[model samples]
Target: MDYNLMREFADSWGLVAMALFFVGAIAFALRPGSRKMADEAAQIPLEDGRS
Candidate 1:
């Protein structure tokens, strides 16, 4: 419950955790064969009830 301890964690581990998440997200988005899935998702709203 100490403020200093929490701040130190946020300044260190929290920063590194967020950076890794950012890198993973960027890599996933840029990977091969993603465009096809993205295009399908984009058309979801326009599709009829028939599957």
Candidate 2:
């Protein structure tokens, strides 16, 4: 089934692509306004005091 070839390909570009995706996700999660938006959304129900 050519396991060696598959492993080599995965180790080459697959690893790089995974690392890039992780970095992009982290950057997006840490971006500005993300936390502020979350905080505002959380306060909406609280201001109304209604579950």
The best candidate by TM-score is 1
What TM-score would every model get versus the actual structure? 0.87, 0.66
Off by over 4 Å in 2: 40-51
Over 1-51, each residue of candidate 2 has an lDDT whose tens digit, in order, gives 499999999999999999999999999978998999878888987696655
Candidate 2, residue 15: lDDT: 100
- Candidate 2 — which pairs collide? none
Model 1, residue 4: C-alpha shift (Å): 0.6
lDDT accuracy of residue 45 in candidate 1: 91
lDDT digits (tens) for residues 13-39 of candidate 1: 999999999999999988999999999
Q: Each prediction's Cα lDDT score?
A: 0.96, 0.91
In candidate 1, stretches whose alpha carbon ends up further than 4 angstroms from where it belongs are: none
Which prediction has the highest lDDT against the true structure?
1
